[model samples]
Target chain A: MASNWEEFYSSHPQPANLSKNEDLLRDFTARHLNGDTRVVLVTSGGTTVPLEHNTVRFVDNFSAGTRGSASTEYFLDHGYAVVFMHRVKSLQPFSRHFTGQKFLNMLDLIETKDGTSVTVTSENIPKIADVLRKYKSALANGKLLELSFTTVYEYLWLLRSACQILAPLKEKCILYLAAAVSDFYIPPNEMSVHKIASTKPQTISLQLVPKILAPLVSLWVPNAFVVSFKLETNKDLLIDKAREALNKYKHKLVIANMLQNYRQKVTLVTQQSSYVIELTTEQSRIGEEIEMYIVKNIVDKHEEFIADRSGRS
Target chain B: MASNWEEFYSSHPQPANLSKNEDLLRDFTARHLNGDTRVVLVTSGGTTVPLEHNTVRFVDNFSAGTRGSASTEYFLDHGYAVVFMHRVKSLQPFSRHFTGQKFLNMLDLIETKDGTSVTVTSENIPKIADVLRKYKSALANGKLLELSFTTVYEYLWLLRSACQILAPLKEKCILYLAAAVSDFYIPPNEMSVHKIASTKPQTISLQLVPKILAPLVSLWVPNAFVVSFKLETNKDLLIDKAREALNKYKHKLVIANMLQNYRQKVTLVTQQSSYVIELTTEQSRIGEEIEMYIVKNIVDKHEEFIADRSGRS
Candidate 1:
């Protein structure tokens, strides 16, 4: 046991891979020191799964990071310090000019079927589910975004940890929860040691894991501004889902979208009213509109809070 | 007669929004006069039909132009002269460091559909078909790539002229025939002034114009190194289509891909063998592989021909 512990201690494991985004973050932070640099946290690309070998497993998503990364630059030009948390293997390298954490682990999990109502202790369930469902076509096409995770437990762990890490920083950040996460994962009892051949009889159950980060918005980080996304196929359900998400996370804003045509079509659902931004008519301008809308809204909300605090003082 | 010609020219004047990309190209051309510099042309994004006052008639591909634009930077780094001809809304801004042509008029094809056949008369047919087929899923989901031409003759005339303009520069060009061109266009007799609606009549007869570029490839530009792409639904049919394309265009290489999971997977079909590049494995690394393969092959081919000429001398 002592030798085992010694071996663990003696073998110098490589330090964590440093992010290339540090320089970019430093420069951005430096620029915002004196200004009301609208700080926007944009997460781009698909999460990566590390395999047994140093290589990767499977990946999903085809974001190209165009919408997110390009919007970051646009936001910066419009005087915003963007904290871009990116997934690995995106087409454009995240400007190594910013400050952000890149969580490079595939979160895997195993859950009972939804009907069974099995209890799960995992975190960030909805976020992971959101990531998976929202980017369904992008994931299916296998274009720019790719992802791989063996189990749901690992995925939940990664998801919760990432949100938690960023949760504390939420005080100054506008959380753009755009990353899609998976809702279903393999159940612990049903998981196979090796690849399960079709010959094997296996019954898999999926249960909704309690959300790990949504509650945190109201419970732990009440001062932080939150914005979540709702992707639905039914138009009627979109606004309701967005409201549910907003109320649940207590977010200031929610972008709800029905599975519309691929041109970045979404409806902005705020506490006051709802607005739809159609990409069908203006496909090329979708990214610009989304980025501008999010940035302006966040900045405006932040300013109002600041003014309110000043007034009280 | 002179007044009529002037009136015609004034009525159909070219749009003057081509300066930014043109200037970049001029500056890029001027930068590398040392002869040690190599050039790479990157054409990206998609173009659309300008229609509405607030909105425009748009036709676009799934082509974010990521592959082409990203690889251009790589080529420029290795020292090469690039004349990039691009459509509207490309992924990257025409690199300020390269020679570029931002032509809004790529290939204007007037297409009408028969029971199972599509007739196109313009050179842009192939590109249009390619984009539509590439974004098949998105189309099914609702966002469609639509094109409307005033006349089939107009489309044919534009295509012919565009090819003629670029023919002389074929010697210095490495044509990356990534754009999907249509196989057929409508004939004059079949033309009609009806907007294609979602609910259509039971029957329609359409006459197809034979592919114009195929004949031009063999007759006009015999020395150019042309590469074409072949997309198929069946694995067995891929090589057959590839061979047909090669024979038709007399191209040196063809990238054959199947519509089955093709958005995520593709094969590099050359004269010798077919290589499948699994996009699921490495994200950014896959982009690297594509760049290396294209660049190395071009460089080697150029060097080999030069060596052969020297040996003959």
Candidate 2:
């Protein structure tokens, strides 16, 4: 049998930067608590399972961190403090809008007598300015805290530390787990110390990674309204799997999505009901992202959850 | 025993875009051939082995495509027309220097009563201009042609198509195989049609990928000076493994490096001798990339090879 999450953590060494990141999170959370702010931890991107300690190769999930990054901005717009934990070099909130060759395409290099200068092209200035204004304001107000991780080990360590810090806030916090974490991994004790050589036929055996949600929901931040994502390629199985996860973890909700149409549609699965949200063809053509709708719905639910808890107390 | 390269290609389906890319390559090659230009096909990044047809997850080699992208620029500087074949979204020649959050950091957004505008900061303008100028010139002069692939299947199909297009050029063509291709893969026939469900423990079986260099050197573009890279984490076996590859493939050179030190140093292995080339710490600190030296050495060897061929004829 595979080790459970607790055993996995005890056996594996904590990431070297975990303590430093925890300290940063502590300060950020403390500041928010004093102001009676609502906080959301948005975990994004894909976690990699390294095959070796020296790691020349890894098992990776397909994710651009589009969902998490996009949702973080919307959360901030709704006046929620966000802990943006994401894969390093994956899309980031403001930077996501300008990544790849898009940034270069948006700029015009002008040459004058003195020298050359690069500026956003006239047609692109409005959109860039809008994103930049929101980004700068978030930073200035310290409402957004950014942290990054690469390997699965680092992500697990940082997640636990973040949860530990958020525990005191209880019902005031929401755990929006959007990251596509690895399902299997070669444990630290089994991974190669060096790169696996290509000189011979190789068999790599990876064990199922213990489900972190087990500890996360049950112990780490028990009172936090936790929402997890369940992505499947089969439409028929999507809602069923999501509902199963919600039942097992006893979390607030599970966002179900089919891999093919995730960008345009998703289903919100709760214990009592499941609702589908989709973007119309016209809306997609006009560049309205599905994340906007998803975030809005989530915010409403989170608010209702807070109200219910406060009434009971 | 594993199947040879020829058998593997015969059994596999051709990448959907292979024929389209071949048309582009054919046209590009004809133009260069008429101009008497030396052409280098630089393969960059890492090919992925998808677990399913929908590809929610993959086994990926750890590479940012730095070696291939940086070297392409140097090759271009030395007046070689380049066919830059790379993994989708991996680094590319001029654009690489500005990727990630670097582009955002190098700019400033200014607001006025009229509107807001973004411009490259004065300190960063010159460097950005130089890179942009070179990138524009390359595209304008038809000196660079790019083709991108994601899966190992696409890489194999495109690679063979590219070689067929370059075959008529013979010795004037150089194959700089820098992409970190997978040594093992789950064939199309075996891959799941949808995403693999994480409902239970699953064991994936992968077969060794046939060595492409064998057919590449002996059949496709036989007269091209082919150089391959051998990346290993073990230092003691690096040179020996590189030499072994050279002997087996009958290729011109193998550039060997330890994964940890690859950015700073590489060992050039040829049939007669091997030589180590390394960058000084000061050079590295000053932002000098080792690709410049590697490309220079390869260019020198290529010239010698051309001369020797002419003498023999």
Candidate 3:
């Protein structure tokens, strides 16, 4: 069946049905082109494990894709072509379709189940409804939503494919590995099962599946400017671990975050220096911090490093 | 001027213009309460920091109050009166309102947004939309959303006020600190004006402010069930750091998360045992795991601990 499935897809040669918001990539690349288009891949949300045919176990996270989507938006605002590989239900609109009257319609249904009722309305209701309508209008117009992905394997597969697409654009491409890919997956054989019955095995144990995505930095994505992330909770040892990951992965930069508080805590670790990022509070107005900061720091460094290596800026 | 402002609000209490949604809080409380309503305080969303008179900086979080609201739902589902202290833009609903047409309306919206626009004559959309509508609807209700504060100082101030409200209910009350707070804040006197003229700071220097909310666990919320979160990024040193924080703050449990991969990686570090959480790619189905695994783990433990300590079931 697997062989047949592969052959069918191979023979069909279908366009990958990718969806997600990658305005950051487009914007980032447009502003600072390294003689090529910069490609960014952002993975998000969590995957599920099938416990049974009817009942499945969800491998999930607390991330609503705020960080990933926010970062993705920043990238787009700056001119980079982004390939956002994400799981389902991320708060981010996979395409502009995630907004509009439909969303508010959900709200309306919640208030008054029957469409004819039209019971719930107030000073704020219209305002809220307007916001929803605007969102839906945006989605209808395809202005907000972009990019897509559904599963862990699917995310990985498309991400690898995106890397391949960006390979030819290497001199100008940048790979920002920000998605939190799952560290494990169900053994392929159990994909169709309904549930892992206790009677089957009192202690069902499995082996760790080596992460195939991380190695991509050193292996396939070597030509592109790569930035990896290392999150540590220890305020004392976060930088050290970040440096270690940078050294091991040989990526240009490592974003280190102290797990103490996540409102806005990201530290950029490079070969020579570590810059702590104090993200603007929720109260602050939106500006180009993530994009501006990275461009000022990483992209410029990439240019300088390349110039020093190849004797051109 | 500050004192005058305080006096104004004190003499003329800010009229609670309770919206229809706010009214739902009462319904939820009544429907959910099991025994004597001892004490309940629920914190939601990101806080806002007042800058100028009308233009205040919002130093909030990326949290949409999904977790907070879900927990609230669980409490209400189990019959508990709750005092919800939330931030702006919370996405949870106060109650579950589902009807025939209302359910179809939700489906139409989902389909319209997805662009499939395929009509589902079946009750699938209503059933699903009814289930998914809680987060946003609950938030629309008149929950206590604390505004003001750019730095952690202001957040701490608002938190203190909330604590004061919950003080009388402290004996059997539970204080759920689910809001994502900024650990750092700008000094009130050090507030600066935004300048688009210069792209750089003339003399960029700032001093660290003391954490205002930390004292609440030991001081104001002494007997309250305090559950604090410690977000970290390192895998190797997670428990050690979490344990250290637990010792310092002496809270009940520290919900620790790795910095960048927080959405996917979580760890529950108690005084004795530690449980590491890894999210799989299961799409929206993962909410169940969040409740069953992480939420249940803590609640069950807390219940057991409380029962053992108080010698009650």
Top lDDT model: 2
- Per-residue CA lDDT of candidate 1, range A163-266, in tens? 44444344455656554443332223333432222222233333333454455465544556666665454466668877777666666787775434323566
What TM-score does prediction 1 earn?
A: 0.37
Q: Score the docking of each candidate (DockQ).
A: 0.01, 0.62, 0.02
Ranking by TM-score: 2, 3, 1
Rank all candidate structures by their lDDT, best first, as comma-separated numbers.
2, 3, 1
Candidate 3: Cα lDDT at B302: 55
Model 3, position B156: C-alpha lDDT score: 54
For all candidates in order, state the fraction of native interface contacts they contain: 0.00, 0.63, 0.00
Error of 3 at A274 (Å): 47
Best candidate according to TM-score: 2
Model 1 misplacement above 4 A: A1-41, A44-83, A86-161, A164-174, A178-224, A228-250, A254-313, B1-81, B86-162, B168-174, B178-224, B229-241, B255-313
C-alpha RMSD for every candidate: 21.9, 1.9, 16.7
Q: Considering summed lDDT, which 10 consecutive residues are worst modelled in model 2 chain A?
A: A197-206
TM-score of 3: 0.44
Worst lDDT run of 10 residues, candidate 3 chain A, spans A196-205
User: How do the predictions measure up, each by TM-score?
Assistant: 0.37, 0.96, 0.44
Residue B147's lDDT within candidate 3 is 33
Score residue A78 of candidate 2 by CA lDDT: 91
Per-residue lDDT, model 2, residue B210, is: 87
